[model samples]
Structure formats: C-alpha cells, structure tokens
Target: MATHVLIIGGGIAGLNAAKSLGDAAGITVTIVDRQNHHLFQPLLYQVAMAGLSPADIAAPIRSILSGFSNIHVLQGEARSIKLDCACVEFDFGVLHYDYLVIACGATHSYFGHAEWEEFAPGLKTVAQATEIRRRVLAAFEQAERIEEPDEQKKYLTFVIVGGGPTGVELAGAIGEMSRYTLARDFRRINPRLTRVILVEAGPRILPMFSEEQAGRAARDLEKLGVQIWTSSIVTNVDANGVEMGDERIQTATALWAAGTEASEIGRSNGMPVDGRGRVIVEPDLSIADHSNVFVAGDQACFTHQTDRPLQGTAPVALQQGRFIGKTIVQELSGKPRTQFQFFDKGQMATIGRSRAIVEIGRFKFAGWFAWVTWLIVHIYYLTGFKNRFFVVLQWAWSYMTFRRGARLIVEKEWRMNQLESEEMLVDTTDDMPR
Candidate 1:
C-alpha cells in the first residue's frame, strides 16, 4: 500500500512540500487548509498598501497542484490532530495518514493586548490586507468631508507599530501613496497634512539587519516623509489611537506589524514549543517522541544550524517544506533522514520609490540598484505566471505614474469590536477614491 502523507496549510512551506511529494512513487499526498488558495505572504504588504489586489498575490491550490495525480486537495480547517490514531479531525470528517506534516503557519501577535486587534490588524492573509486597505482609504475619504482641521488630522494620520520589514514597508508605502498617489486626488486634504509614524520598541528599526543597512532604510523612509520613532513602546491602543508611555498619538488608523506566534496547532498537541509557540523540532524537523510527524513553516522552531530560531520568512519555509518532503521519501526507502540546514539567501526590504537594501553574505547594498534587485527577485518568486505578469505590469505603471491602481475601500468597518466597545456603528461602506 502507498504511504499516505497528510499536509496542513497551503502557505509557502506546505504547498512546496505538497508539490515535492505529488509525483513520488508509493506515496499519496493529501493537503488540507482553511483557505482554498495559496497566499504569497512576502508581498502581502503590497496588498495591504493598495499596491496590489488580493488576487495578485493568491492562487487557487487546486490549480497549483493539478498536474499531480497522486495528490488530493481538501478545503477544510483542522479541528485537532489525533497523533495516537495518526488522523486529523476536521469539522466535516477525519482523515488518517501514514506520515503527517503540520504547517499551519502563524498569526499576528499583539503582545499582551488582545483588545487591540480590532483597532489595529496585522497583515497575514488577503482578508487582513483588504481590511487594512479599507481603513487607509476610508481614513482619507473621511478626512475629505470633515470641516475641523483637528478632526481631519486625526483621520489623515496613520500609525504603524513595529519597525521590522513589514512596518517599514507599510510606512513607506503609505507615505508614498498619500504624497504621490492621492496627493492630487484630494483637494481638501493637502499632501503635506498626511502623517505616517512608525513606532518601534527597539533602539533601531530592522533590528535583524546590520546598523548600516537599518540606517539607510530609516533615511529612505524619512525621505518619503514617514516619521521614524525608535525606542518607543506602545502602552495602549484605543479607537482614538495609541499611547506610548505618557504620549498619545491620536489617529483613526493604527496598524500592527509587531510580532507573530505560531498557529494554535503547535500547542494543541502538547508538543514542546518555543516562546513564540513554534513546535521544537529535531534536527530533521520532526517533533520529539513522534518521528512520523514533522513540522514546517512558521509553525516550527528550528535552531539546529543557528543560535536563534529561523525567522518565519518565505525562503526558510520553502527550504523546510522541500526538506520534509524528501525526508519522508527517505523514510519510505529505509534511508537515514538528513538534518535540515537553511541556506541563508540573505535579506532584502524596499523602503519606497527607488530605495531598498539587500544583504547576501559579505555583499550589502542599498538604493536604486538594490530596489531593482528586490523587484526582480520578488517577481521571480511569485507562484503563477499570470500573477507575476500582472504584478510586473502594475509595478511598472506605478513606477512611471506614481499611482496605486487598487485603492479600493470595499470594507468600511475597519474596527468592529472597538466600535462595539465604544458603542458606535462604523459605516463600512464600499467605495472608490474620489
């Protein structure tokens, strides 16, 4: 009988693993995910910033793995994993497997402030990106109608917490959008009136990057008119805005790019996990005491090759996915499983128009050339041909015209729970920019 392999999640790691195992002999793969499509998470910031639509970064899972006859795709959220029985329970039914790869990915971490999610949602999936876009565009629209300058300032200001790649990227994009894209679109709201503040608790933004690279990125963002507030910790997040220590920055929109924790599955099975709730896996990426079950993507805490656990980047996940699939193949062949070692492909982040930073081993560079490199690299990594084509075309047009075409306010209700707490009803009406 063929070895049945069950894989969860359709993100970079899971999908890559599914693709690797799809055609293997004596093996049948089953992939189950909460969403039907695979999301290109690295560029999800682009979607959140209105640079790209949701469809531009996501592709149907069925089409992605259609060429594989031995692979089965199911769209169902897993309720729990029954390791004892080698099965996963979904709301619809239960599916058993000879080998299991858990890759449920991760979600946004609000630190200890669970109440802040309603006011400030992080970028992860298409829904959260669209919701963020709505908040930004609607804030501009709301500012256009307000008569009082103070009220308009509140609406015009956008605060982003966390100065990592996501925070920096979002802040820079919003700054460019408000200054260039929507600058001429609105008559009442002056381009100079818009404010984007990036708050980071660390002493420097992009703490992972070298001091020189982080400095360059900070300068680039400042050139785009984004306020860089380092060493600032947010004490509170309310509907009005965020409070840092004794200071309160009043704004209508606050975005959280702070931190991420693994999906609930990591802790649900009683496996040992890191502080971020990522499953502590063996050198082969399998959990201790359960060699048949392996974990990948943002769900696994792999520290074998490095002092720190690998960052939940797309590249790491891609490598882990391929490694896990091959490991399973090795297991089936009665061969030894190789220890997973991540290839450090380096890191890159775009600050705004014609500004970016790239680090590869000893080589490090920033500015226009670096930006082009970043662009080409992203376009090359996107899943489908159609997605890549459209994204390239859109970016080219944006580069020339300074316009983000996907400025849609489809969802008006930006803060549902916060509004509920405040006893207010938000008009989450879908509309286009005037």
Candidate 2:
C-alpha cells in the first residue's frame, strides 16, 4: 500500500506543507479545507481599508498546487480524526492515512461574550473584512443624513477594543483616510473631526514589543489624532456604543482585535488545549499519545528552552509547518526525527504614511525610516511578486495623491436579502416540482 498523508486546513501552514512536500518522495499527499481559496490573513486589514482587493490577497487552492501530480486538493470540512483506526473522517468520507497534519488556524475569541461579535467583529477572513468595510463606510453615510448632533458623534467615532497590531494598523489607516483621503468628500461632517479610539485592557499597547518601541508607537498614533485608552476594559458592547468599566463611550463602529482561540475541532476532539484553546504539542510538533496526528500554526503551542511559550506569528507557523513536512519525509525514509527550531524575524507595525516602528534584536528604529523598513518587509513577505508590486504602487499612490478608489460598497444588505429570498423560492419550487 502507498503511504498516504492527510493534511487538514489550507491556510499558510497547510499550503506551505503541501508545497514543501510536493510528490518527488514516494508518498501521496491530500490536502483538505473547508474553503476553496487560501487567504493572505496578514493583509486582511488592508482589504478592510480598501487598500487591496479580495482577489489580490486570495488565491484558488487548486491553482497554486495543480502542477503536483501526486497531490490532491479536496474541499471538505474535517469532522473528526479516528486515532485508533489511523484514519481521518470528513463530512464526505473517511481517508485512511499513515500520517496526519492539523493546521487548523485560530478564530476570534469573544472572551465568553460571544454576542459582542455582532457589534465588534474581528477581521479573520474575506467575508468578515468586507462586512466590516460595509459597516465602516455606511457609518459615514448614515451620519451625513442624520440631523441630531448626538447621533452624528456616534457615527463619526470608531472604537477599537484591542491595541494590538491589528487595532493599531486599522486605527492609523482610518485616521489617514479621515484626515487626508476623505477629508473634503463630506460636506456636513468634518472628516478631520473623526475620532479613532483605541482601547487596551493592558497597561500598554503592543505588549509583545519592547517598552520603548511600544511607547513610541503609541505616541505617534496619538500625534495622528487617535485617542489611546489604556488600562480600560470593555465591560459591554452594543450597537450604539461600548461600556468601559464605569464610562459609556458611544461609537458607530467597534472593532475586535483582542484575542483568538483554536478551532472548534480542537475543543470538540478533547485535545490538550491551553486556556486560549491552542493545542499543546510535543517537541516534534505532535500531539501527546497521538504520534500520528500532528498540529502546528496558531492552533498549536510549544515552549522554548527559556520557558517562553511560542507566540502565534506567521514565521512560527511557517517554520513549524515546514519542520513537520521534513519530519514526515524523514519518518517515511526511516530517518531520525528533528526538533522544531524557531527563528524570530523581528516585528514591525506602521501607524501612518511616514510613521512606523521596527525592532530587530537589540537594534530599534522609529519614525519615517522605520515606516519605510516596515513597508519593505511586508511587501517582501506577501505572496507573489505581482501582489507585492501592486501593493507597493497602491500605497505609494495613496501616500502621494491621497485617493483610494476602492471605497465603493459592493455588497449591500438589501441585495443579500433579495438573493436569499430568491434562493428560498427556488428551493421551494424544486421540492414541489411545479
């Protein structure tokens, strides 16, 4: 029998694993994902801000790996893994495998308040991004029509619940849009008066970064007119506004960039998950007691020699996925397994057009120079040269011209309702056969 390898989830880790293990070795690889396309999650915020299109950031899974004759891609949601049978079960059918890799990524954790998701949605996928974009753009339009000052204040203000990279980047982008991009577009409301509020439960923003860098980044954002509210936790979130401890801050838009938890698959399977729902993996990235089933990316967790738990970053996911690929290949060839060694690639976050902060080891930089470095690093890491070129050009044009043409709202709620009703009618007719 041929050695069949089953890979779950087609995100960065799963796709990279498939690419790394493309069938020159005498093994057959099958990748399964719920979605047909692979999304560039890192650039999801750009899509929300109309900096890039969905097509620019997403690629068909089959197109990327169609050249590999030994690899097959299936669009299916994984139901469960039968460890005793050495088989993986999906909604479609069972696939027996000698080895299995689970790269199922994390999802937005509502922190026990799942209802808050409707008000303060996080950007994880393409649908969520476009939905948020609609809400944001709609707020401006709605505010313009309202006559009440109180309602107008709510519309012109935006509250970001987390001060992490996503929150900071979004706040900065929206600030730029209000101050420069759409400054003169609105007649009634002064776009310059638009408030971008960033609320952090922690004492400082960007807790992952060094204190100096974090402090500087916060300062830069404040200079750009962002209201930084640190050490404040959101007690309640509603359509109108969010309650912060004892204070009630009103805003039309509330963005969640707070926390993430592993997929329901991990929780349902009774795997050893952390407090945040990340599966705990052994040194070789395999789940304990289930050596055949491995986990990586944001879905898996490992501690370094210094007892520092690995953070869910892109580099960590990529490295772990590639390591798992090599380890699987070694096992098939009857070679000894190797431990996963992670290399920290530093961190960068841009605030505005000419403002950013970058930390590379002991060296640190901020301001325009850091911003340039940040842009270069992001453009370099983004998949495909075409995307990189267009993204760079887009940012350059926006920086120089202060115009973003992707502001048109594509998906309206009314249109969606109409389509749903039409589909329902078709279903009813098909069932009746009239």
Candidate 3:
C-alpha cells in the first residue's frame, strides 16, 4: 500500500504540494483546512477597492483538486497533533499519517498590541477584505449624511500603517478608488475629498526594493494624493483613528499591513522558530530532526549563505513547496535527495493606472511600460484562466473609462457563537502559541 500523507492548510503551498505529490502513484493525500474556498491573496486589495468581486479571486478548494481521485479536501480545522503517534487532531476527529507536510502559511501580527485590531484591520483573507470594503463605503455614506465640518474631516481621512508592498498597493488603490472611481458618483459627498495617509516606522517605504525604485513608487503615489510619512511609528490605534508618537490623526479607516508571522503549527509541534514566529528549517526545507515533516511557504524561515531569511512571497512559497514534494517522492522511490534552491524573480508594484516600478535583474523600469508589465504579471500569476480574463477586462475598462465596477457594498450576515467575537472574525484554529 502507498504511504498516507496528510497536508494541513489549503493555501498555495498546500495545494501546489498536493498537485506535485498527486502525480506520483505512491501517495494518498488528504488536505484539511478551515475554509473550502482558496483565495488568491495577492489581489485582495483589488477586491477591497471594488475592482474585483470576491468570487473573481476566490475558488472552491474542492474544484481545484477535483482531478485527483487519491486526494481529498476536508473543510474543517485541525486542533492539535500527536507527534509521537504521527496523527493529527481535528474538529472531525483524528487523521494518521506516515509523512506530514505543514504549509499553513502566516497570520497578521499585532506587535503584541491586539487591542489595535479594533481600528486597524489587516487584509489577509476574503472576509477581512469585504469588511474593509464595507467600512470604506460606510465612511463615505456617513460623511455624506453629516453636515458638521469636523465630523466630515474624520470621515474623509484614511490612515494606512505600514510601508511594505501590501501597504503601498492598498494606499494607492484606496486613493484611486476615492479620487477617480467615486469622484462623480456621490451627490452629497466627494470621495475625492478623502485624504490617504501612509505611515512607515522605517526610514523608507519598500525597503526590500532598490532605493531608486522605492523612491519612484513613493513619488507616483504622492502624485495620486497619498500622504506618505516615513520613519514614523504608530503608538496607538482605536475606532476613532491612529496615534503616532505624539501626533494623533482622526480617520474612519486605518489599515494594518506592517507584519505577519507563521501559523502556530510549527511552534505547537515543537519546531524551532525565530523572533517573528517563522519555523526554522534546514536547507532542504525540512524541520530540524524531523525528515518526514516539512515546512514551506510563509511558514518556513530558512537562512541563505548571507544569513538573510527568505522573504514571504508566493514565488518563494511555491518553489519551496514543489521542492519538498520532489524530495519526498525521491525518498519514497529510494532515490537521492537534493537540496532546495530559490530562483530570484524580479518584483514590481503599480501605483495607479499608468504608474508603476519594476526591477528585473539589472534592468529597472518605471512609469507606463512598467505598469503594463505589472498588470500582465499579476494576471499570469492568477490561479484560473477565468480569473485572469475577468481581472484583465476589469483593468482594461478601468484604464480606459477611469471607473471601478465592483463598488457595490455587500453586507453579508452570519452567526457566531457567544464565545466567538466577530470583529474581523479571527481564525484561531491555527493560533497555537508556543
């Protein structure tokens, strides 16, 4: 009989891993996750800004893995693990495995200040994106109804706390959504009156990018009416607004894109983790002292020759996942195992319709050409062809007409237990702190 392999989490890492292993005849796979839908998280900001619907970027996990009869997708959460017995504990019961691959990915880190979540919600899932959309639209609605200048000021301002790619993308999208998309749509309020504030605790935005590229991105976003604050730390965040050092700004929406850490599967299973809560793994992407157990994607923190931990991005995660699958297959087939290597792909971000910055090897490009490249690259990375077509058409229309189509507010109602608080709807199934 083939060895039973159970994978946890249905993100890119887990899904790709299953695909790699499913092609081999000696593996029987079972995937367990809390949500049945698989979300393309890179474009979540587009959804929040009403550029794309939730269904456009999200798909049923079952549909993606339906081709493999040996693979099963379970829509539930894993509770715990019995390492000694090689079994996983879940809400549905227990699942035994010969080899376990944990690619549960990361969660937003509140920097030990969980209270800040009430004001500054992070965009990591479809639900969070939808909630942010509601809040953003609600701010405009509330502003339209109010006649007070002070109250209107509060409603028209937005603060984003972070300087990373997610922060930059969101800040730029929000600015466009307000100034261009909804400028002529509102009767009583001008969404163009919205002020976008981006605060970075670091010296510059996009520190990972080349200094010139980062500076160019900042300049483009500034031209779009986004206020950039560098070397500033947010001391507090509440429903009213965000407080940075001694300066306090009143705004209706504050977004958190500062930091993220690995899911608790590593720490809970007695694996080594770093200060940021990422699992420490070997060069081959296997957790220390446990060859049968592997970690990949945003969850694993393996250092390079320079001792720099790999960045948490889709490319890195997908490569690491495929490597793990190949290595496991080799071991199962009595073949040699090879060390994992990451191929460096260039990075790019779009500021607006015709403004972007891209870094590819020695060639760095900015402006309209790079913006077109950015759009193409994002569409290519999308999961399905249907999604690619939909996003492309949406972008084409937005670029030509200067209008966003998905601005309709959808307030979805659902029930939660008394013990469960609904603000952002925390997915604590994997919150096993070490």
Candidate 4:
C-alpha cells in the first residue's frame, strides 16, 4: 500500500516537510490548514504598521504546492488528533493516515490575563495585523476631531508591552510612522507628538540577545523617540489603557508582543506537553512509542541536542521540518532515522530603517550594514519570485520616499457588516431558480 502522510498546518515547517516528500514516488501528502495561504510571519509587523499589504507577505498554499501532484492542500481546521487510531478528525470529517506530522504552530498568549487581549492584540495572523493597523490609524483621526487636549493625548499615547523582537520592531515602526509617514498628513494634531512607549517586564529589552546588543538596541530606540520602560510588569489592562506596576499610562492603543503559547491543537490528545503546551517529541521529532507520528515547528519541545528546548524561530522550524521530511524518506528506504540537530544560523533583529543588530558566531555587528544584511536574508526566504520582486521594489521605494502604500483602513466593524450584507445578497441571487 502507498504511504499516506498527513501534515497539519501550512506554515514554514509544514510546507518544507511536504516539499521534501513531494518527489517520493510511493508517498502521498495532504496539507490541512485553517487558512489557504502561507504567511511570512517575520514581516507580519510590517503589515500591522501598514508598511506592506497582506498579499505582499503571503501566498496561497495551493499555488505553492501546485508543482507536486502527489501533494494535496485542504482548507479546514483539524479538530483533534486521534493517536490511538492514527487518524485526524477535522471539523468536516476524519482521515486516517500511515504517517502524521503536526506543525500547527503557536498563537498569541495573554499570560494569565485573557481579558487583556481585547485591549492589546498581538500580531499572529493577517486579521489581527489589519485590526491593529485600523486601531492605530483611527487613533490619529480621532485625535484630530477632538477638542480636549487630555482626550487627544489619550488617543496619541501608544503603549507596547514586551521588549522582545516583536515589541521592538513594532515600537520602531510606529515611531517612524508618527515622526515621518503621517507627520505632514495631519494638520490638527501633530503626528510627531504621538507618544510611543515600549514596556518590558525584564531588566532590559531583547533579553534573548547579549547585554551589549540589547543595550545598543535600547539606545537606537531612544533616538527614534521611543520610551523604553524596563522591569515594568503590567498589572491590569482595560479599554482605557494599561497599568504597569505602580505607574499607569492612559492610552487608546495598547499592543501586546509579550508571549505566545502553542495553538489549541497542540494541547490535545492527552499527549505529553511542556508548560507552553508543545508536544514533547523524541529525538527524531516523533512522539514516543509512535515513531510514525511526528511533530515539528512551534508545536514540538525538542531538547535532545541542547540544554534547553529550541526557541520557536523560523530557522529552528525550517531545520526541524526539513530534517523530519528527510528522515521519513530514509526510514522508507530501510535506513535508520537520525536524530534532528538544528544548525544555529545566528540571530538578528531590525530596529528601524538603516538600523539593526546581528550576531553570527564571533562576528557581532550593528548599524546600517547589519540592517542591509537583515533585509537581504529576509528577501531570500520570502516564498515566491513575485513576492521577492515586489518586496524589493516596495523596500526600495519606501527607503527612498519614507512612505508606505498599504495604509488604507477598509475593515472596520461597520465596514465588515456592510461587506457581509453584500456577500449575502450575492449568495441569495445565486440561489434563485436560474
């Protein structure tokens, strides 16, 4: 019988794994995902800041796997994994498989406070990114219409919690947008007066990086008018704003870039999982006692090769997914499955235009050169030729003009209702006896 491989998720890991097995003659692959597209998550911040449209950083999954006739893409959510039966149950139905690969990835985590999510949305999906962009742009517009300085100040103050790469990137982009992008457009309330604050619970921002690198990033942010509040733990978050310890900042827009937990799918089937709910897989990226079932990407806790489990970075996911793919092929060919080992390609994070920090082994660098390196690396990893071409074109234009093109606010609550109505009308007409 031919081997049927079922892969959950269409993210970097899942896509890479399916590709690795695409040419294998006897293996058939099925990719299941909630969304039809694969998102370039690193650039999601750019979307939230309206620097790039969603399509620029995303591509349909079908298009990506069209070259492989053996691979099929299904648009649906996997409800649960039935390990005992070696089958996956979807919202629509269930499918049994010879091999299962789980790479559902992670989602926005509110720590212990789920209520905070209403006030501060994290950038995990395209919908959330666009919602943030609307809130940000609307804040400026609301400030312009208001007469009270206090009310206007409330609209202008923006607070970003967490000092990780996501927080730093978000704060920097907003700072630039306020000081440059919307500065000339707003006449009533000066966009330059918009206050951008970054709150970190740790001693410093970018805690994952070296102290020297972290300190440099902090300084670079200050230059862009971003106020970094270190060692400030948020006690409460509401519609009004957020309360960080004893200090309280009244702001209209509060963005969360704090932490992420494994997606709901990761917390399933009574499988052994870590604190973050990621599946604890064997050294070969397979579940214990069930080598046929594997886990990769943000859904797996792999600590065999290192003292600690690997962080859920793109490079880590890519390596894990690719290794699993190759290992499956080897097992089919009667070769032993080797343990997965991640080759650290180093880490880098961009501050703003012409400013970034990079660490690659002994080589440590920051400034414009590091920023250029960051750009080249990201451009290289983008999915399609069209994406790379347009991204480069847009980056060139933005660098030269200091402006973003995808700054339109079209998905507000009322606007979405109108769209829903239009869709209903179209559906009703299609149902007419014609």
Candidate 5:
C-alpha cells in the first residue's frame, strides 16, 4: 500500500509540499484547507486600499494542483488531530494518514483586548479587507454629507495602529488616495485634507529594518502627508476613535495592523507551542515525541542561529515547505533526513509609489531603484500568469492616471443610507476635474 500523507492548510507551505512530493513512488498527497483559493498575502494591503481586486491576488487551489495526478485537494477545515489513531477529524468526516503536515497560518492578535476587534478590524482575509474598504469609503461619503466641520474632521481622520509593514503600507496608500486619487473627485470637501495617522508602540517604524532605512521610510511617509506617531501606545478603542495615553483622537475609521497569534490548530491537540501559540518543532521540523507529525509556515516556531524565532515571512515558509517534503521523500527512500537550513535572500517594503527600501545581507538601499526591484521581485513570485498580467496593467494605468479602478464601495446598505440622507448627493460626473 502507498503511504498516505495528509497535509493541512493550503497555504504556501502546504502547497509547496504537495508539489514537491508529486509523482513520487509509493506516496499519495492530500491537501486540505478551509478556503478553496490560495491567497497572495503580501499584496493583501493593495486590495484593502482599493488598488487591486481580490481576484487579482487569489487563485483556486484545485486549478493550481490539477496537473499533479498524485495529489488530491480537499476543501475542508481540520477540527482536531487524533495522534494515537493518526487521523484528522473535520466537520464532514475523518481521514487516516501515515504522516501529517500542519501548516495553518496565523491571525490578528488584540493583545488581551478581544473587545477591540469589532471597532478595529485587522487585515487578514478577503472579507476583512472588503470590510475595511467599506468602512473607509463610507467614512468619506459621510464626511461629505456632514456640514459640521468637527463631525467632518472626525470622519476624515483615519488611524492605523502599528508601524510594521502592513501599517506603514496602509497609511501610505490612504495618504496617496486622499492626496491624489480622490483629490479632484469631491465637490463639497477636499479629500486632500484627510488625516492619516500611523501609530506605533515602538520607538521606530519597521523594526525589522535598520534605523537608517526606517528613518528614510518615515521621511517618505511624511512627504506623502502621512502623520507618524512613534512610542504611542493605544490604551483603548471604540466606535468614536482611539485612546492613546492621555489623548483621544476622534475618528470613524480605525484599522488594526498590530501583532499576530498563531491559528487555533497551533494551540490544540496537545501540540507543544510557544508564547505566541506557534508550534514548537524539533530540529527536523517534526513535533517532539511524534515523528510522523510535522509543522511549518507561520505556525512553526523555528530557531536557527538567532536568539529569537524566525519571522513569519513567505521565504521562510517556502523553504521549510520544500525542506519538509524533501526530508519525507529521503526518509521513505531509506536515506537519512537532512536538517533544515534557511537561506536569507533579503527583505524589502514599499512605502508608496516609486519609493521602497531593501536590505540584502550587508547591503542596504532605499528609493526609486529599490522600488523597481520590489516590483520586479513581487511580480516574479506571483502565482498565476493572468494575475501578474492584470496587476502590471492596473499598476501602469494607475501610475499614469493617478486613479484607482478598484475604488468601488461594494456594500449596499451604506450607499443606500448616503443616498437617503438629507444632504444632496453632488453629481460626481459633472464635479470631476477634467
């Protein structure tokens, strides 16, 4: 009988593992995930900022793995793992496996304040991105209708908590949208007056990058009209606004790009996990005392030469995925399994259009050249050719016209409320600047 390998989570790690084991003798791979599609998470901020559609970054898992006859894709969430029986239980049924791979990713963490989630939604999934998009567009529309300046200011004020890559990117995008994209679209209020504040608890933004790079990024953000508030810790959040220290800033839209915790699977099934709920794996990426069970991706707490755990990046996940697959194949072929080694390629984050910072090994650079490099690297790694082509076209058009095509407010109730309000809706077609 062939060895039945069950891989949980269709993320980068899981997908890569399935592909690596394709057509291998005496082995069959089954990939199970909660979502039917594989999402390119690095570009999720663009979708939230109305720069790109969801379809441009997500591809169906079945379509991606259809060419491999040895692989089977299952659309289901794994509820629990029976270690003794070597089977995973889902809502529909259970499947036994000779070996199990868990690559479930992470989610937003509210830092012991779960109630704040409703007021400040984090960008993790497509639904969350669209919800944020709705809130942002709704706030602008409401601000246009309100005659009171104080009320309008509240609506125009946007707060993004956290100064990491996600927060910085979001603040920059909002600033650009207000200053450039929507500047000439409004008649009653100037969108250029919109205030975008990036609040960071740490002393500097982009702690992962060097102090020089972080300073440059901050300067670029300020140039784009984004306010930076470092060493500011958010104490409370509500429908009105966020409370930091002794000050309260009134705003209708508050976004959370703060810390993250591992998925529920990391903490369940008696798996050994760290403080952040990531599965603590052995040197070979296997669970302690359970050789047949393995963990990868953001959920795996891997410590190489550094004192801290590895950052939850796509490169780490991809390398670990390939390592785990190769290790399994070698062991099955009566060869010794090899220890996992991570090759540090580099890290890069885009501040806004035509601006970015990149660090590779001992070399670090910033500005337009880095931005071009960032664009090329991301486009090269994008999953599907169609997505890559559409993304490039959209980016080129937006760069030339300074307009975002995906700035569509999808929610119906919000639009209905704005239309029914007492304030007259200005004719957008006539008011738009030619």
Candidate 6:
C-alpha cells in the first residue's frame, strides 16, 4: 500500500512539500487548505495599497500542482486531528494519513485587544487587503465630500500602527498615494497635505533589520512625507483614531501591521505549543511522541539553534517544507532522517519606489540598487510567469507615471447590510433608554 501523506495549509510550506514529493514511488500527497488559491504574502501590502490586484499575487492551488499526478488538492478546513487514529477531521469528512504535515500559518494579533480590529484592519488575506484598499480610498472620497476643514483633515489623516516591515511599507505607500498618485485627482482636498504617521513602540522601525538600515529607511520615508514615531506604543484604537501613551491622533483610517499568532490548529490536537501558540516540534520538525506528525511554517516554533526561535519567513518555511518532504522520502526508503538546519539568506524591505534596504551577512546597503534588488527578488519568487510579467509592467508604469493601477474602491453588500444593522440597533437602544 502507498503511504498517504496529508499536508494542511496551501501556503509556501505546504505547496513546496507537495512539489518536492511529486511522483514519488509508493507515496500519495494530499494537500488541504481553506483557501482555494495560494497567496504570495510578501507583496500583500502592494495589493492593499492598490499597486497590484489580488489576482496578480494569487494562483489557484490546483493549477500549480496539476502537473503532479500523485498530488491531490482539497479545499477544506482541518478542524481536528486524531493522533491515535492518524486521521484529520473536517466539516465534510475525515482523512486518514500515514504521515501528516501541518503548516496552517498565522493571523494578525491585536495584542489582546481584538476590538481594535474593527477600526484598524490588518493585511493578511485577499479579503483583508481589498477591504483595506476600500477603506483607504473611501477616506479620500469622504474627505473630498466634507466641507469642513477639520473634518476633511481628519479624513486626510492616515495612521499606521506597528512600525514593522508591513507598517513601514504601508505608510510609505500611503504617503506616495497621497503626494503623487491622488495629488492631481482630488480638487477640494489636497492629497499632498495628507498626514501619514507610522507608529512603532520599539526604539526604531524595522526592528528585524540593523539599526543603520532602519535609520536609512526612516530617512527614505521622510523624503516621501511619512512621519515616523519611535518608542511610541498605540494604547488604544477606535473608529475615530489611535491613542499612543498620552498622545491622541484623530483619523478616519488606521492600519495594523504589528504582531501575529499561530493558527488555531497549532494550539489544538494536544500538541505542545509555545506562548504564541506555535507547535513545539522536535529537531526533525516532528511533534513529541508522534514522529509521524510534523509541523512547519509559522505554526511551528522551531528553535534548532540557540534559545531564540526562527522567524516565520517564507524562506524558513520553504526550506522546512523541502526538508520534511525529503525526510519522508528517506524514511520510506529505509534511510536515516537528518535534523533540519536553516540557512540565513539575509532580508530585504522596500520603503517605496527607488528606495529600499538590503542586508546579507556582513554586507548591508540602502538605496535604489537595493530597491531594484528587492523588485527582482520578489518578481522572481512570484508563482506564475504572467503574474511576474504583469507585476513588473505595472510597477514600471507606476514608477514612471506615479499612478496606481488597481485603485478601485470595491464595496461589498455585506458592509452595507452591516451599517443598516448598526443603525437599527442604535434606533432600538435610543427608543428604550432616553
């Protein structure tokens, strides 16, 4: 009988695992994910900023793995895992597996303040990105319609919480959009007067990068009209604005890019998980007392070297996925399994067009060269050829024209229904109380 290998989550890790184990003898791979498409998350900020469409960075999971006959892609969510029976329970049915790999990935963490999510949205999935785009574009539209200067200023103000890469990138994009993209478009309100504030609790933005790089990024952002506030924590967030310490800034739009917690699957199944809810796995990426079960990507707390855990990056997930696939093949072939060792291949973050920071080993640089490098690297990693081509072309056009191609404010019916529901609730409360 062939070995039934079940992989959960169709992110980078799961896709790479399935691809690595393609056409393997005596092995069949089954990959399951709630999302039907695989999203390239690194450039998700661009989508939210209207630089690229969701389709530009996403590809159907089935289409990507269709070449492999032994691999099957299932669009379903994994609800539970039965360790004794080695079966995964879903809404539809259960899937029995000889080996299992969990890489469900992470979501935005509001640091115990879930209510903030209503006001400050996070960029994670396509829906979230589109919603952010709508909110951002709508702010400008609202500003244009409002006759009062103070109200228009409030609508023009954009606050970004978290100062990490996502925060920095988003702030820069908004700055560019205000100063350049929407500058000439708006008549009543000058988009150039838009205030883009980036708030970071840490001493510096892009804490993952070196201090020098972070400083350079700050300077680059300032050139684009972005105000950076370091050592400032967002104490509260609401529909009106964000509060940091004793300071309160009134705004209509707020974007969150702070922290992330692991998927629910990592916390469940009796697996030992860390404080962040990432499954604590062995050196071989397998859960304790369950060698057949493995975890990878953001969901796994892998601390192979020293006490610090590995950062949940795409490269780490990709390498871990490949390692898991190879290890499974070796085990089936009666070969010894080896421990996973991560190779640090440096990091890069783009501040805006023609500006970025790159750090690799002892070498670090920031400028247009780094920005070009960032573009090349991201375009190269994109899934399909068409996606890569279109991204490059769109970026080139935007770079030359200072115009965003995907700036449509998409309004869903759910939001309209939600507003109506809120109004009804308010009316009922008013009739009952005062």
lDDT values, one for every candidate: 0.92, 0.87, 0.86, 0.92, 0.91, 0.93
Candidate 3, position 209, lDDT = 90
Q: Candidate 2 local accuracy as lDDT?
A: 0.87
Give the Å shift of residue 307 in candidate 2: 1.5
Alpha carbon deviation, residue 1, candidate 2 (Å): 3.1
TM-scores of the models, in the order given:
0.94, 0.94, 0.93, 0.95, 0.94, 0.95
* Alpha-carbon shift of residue 125 in model 2 (angstroms): 0.4
> Tens-digit lDDT track for model 5 on 1-434?
99999999888899888888888889999999999999888999899999999999899999999998989999998899999889999977999999899999999999999999999999989889988988998899999899999999999999999999999999999999999998888899999999999999999999999999999999999998999999999999999999998988999999999899999886888898999999989889998888988899999998854757999998988899888888889999999867678888999999999989999987999999999998898888788899999999999999999999898888745465676453444665557789
Please write out the lDDT profile of model 4 over residues 287-325, one tens digit for every residue. 988889999999899999886989999999898889888
- Candidate 3 lDDT by residue in tens digits, 1-434: 88888889888888888888875787899988899988888889888878889988888989988888889899888888777788999999999998888888898988999888878889989889988888888889899999999999999999989999999998999898888878887898888878999999999999989999999999988988999999998899988889988999999889999999888877886779998878888888877667788888898898953488998888888888788778888898899777788887888877877888998888999999998898888888788888888888888898889888888777675554534664235555346465
In candidate 1, how many clashes are counted?
2
Judge candidate 4 at residue 28 and give its lDDT.
92
Residue-wise lDDT of candidate 1 within 1-434, one digit each (tens)?
Answer: 99999999988999999988989999999999999999998899999889999899899999999999999999999998988888999977999999999999999998878999999999998989999999999999999999998889999999999999999999999998888889889987786668999999999999989999999999999988899888898999999989999989999999999999999887987889988999999999998888999999999999999878999998999999999998888778899888999999999999988999999988999999999999999999999999999999999999999999899889655565875655433333334344
Candidate 2 residue 333 C-alpha distance from true site, Å: 1.7
C-alpha displacement of 283 in model 5, angstroms?
Answer: 1.3
Q: Which residue segments of model 4 deviate by more than 4 Å?
A: 414-434
Q: What are the C-alpha RMSDs, in order, of all predicted structures?
A: 6.1, 2.6, 6.2, 3.6, 7.8, 4.1
**Candidate 6: 10-residue stretch with minimal lDDT:** 411-420
Error of 2 at 150 (Å): 1.0
Please report how far candidate 2 places residue 359 from its true position, in Å: 1.1
Alpha-carbon RMSD, candidate 1: 6.1
Give every collision pair in model 2.
Answer: none
